[model samples]
Target: MSGSHLHSHDHAHGHVPVHSHGPASPHPAQAAPWSILRMTVVSRLAAAVAVSAAMWAVVWLSMR
Candidate 1:
């Protein structure tokens, strides 16, 4: 076959195997107490709603 010569060593496809020693480290944002990454889903939704309300109020006041 045309591709019969491709079967050689294990890394013939140009990708080296990776090994993990232990658990992965947490993301930087998750490590901060005041970061949004630490916020729960409900809290994030509430924050979004509060911001939207504030924006609409500002626009309404400016248009009056």
Candidate 2:
């Protein structure tokens, strides 16, 4: 077999090499009113705070 076998189908199909297909929409999050970005951030923050409180409770109980 030759090195040509290692080549991608993009060239064979006369298609340009695309490194990235960027966001579908310029303002992806804002494009959709029900976008999960805001909810995701809020959930993550709430989880962090809950985890920290749980850890502190554990430490307090251990020290008592």
Best by TM-score: 1
The most accurate candidate by lDDT is 1
User: TM-score for each prediction?
Assistant: 0.49, 0.39
Q: How would you encode candidate 1's per-residue C-alpha lDDT over 1-64 as one tens digit per residue?
A: 8766866667578786565443485434334458787799999999999999999999999999
lDDT of each: 0.79, 0.72
Clashing pairs in 2: none
Q: What is the lDDT for 44 in model 2?
A: 78
Supply the TM-score for candidate 1.
0.49
Backbone clashes, each candidate: 0, 0
Q: Positional deviation of 13 in candidate 1, in angstroms? A: 54
Q: On residues 1-64, what C-alpha lDDT tens digit does candidate 2 reach at each position?
A: 7655666555476676554446564533336665445678778789789999999999999999
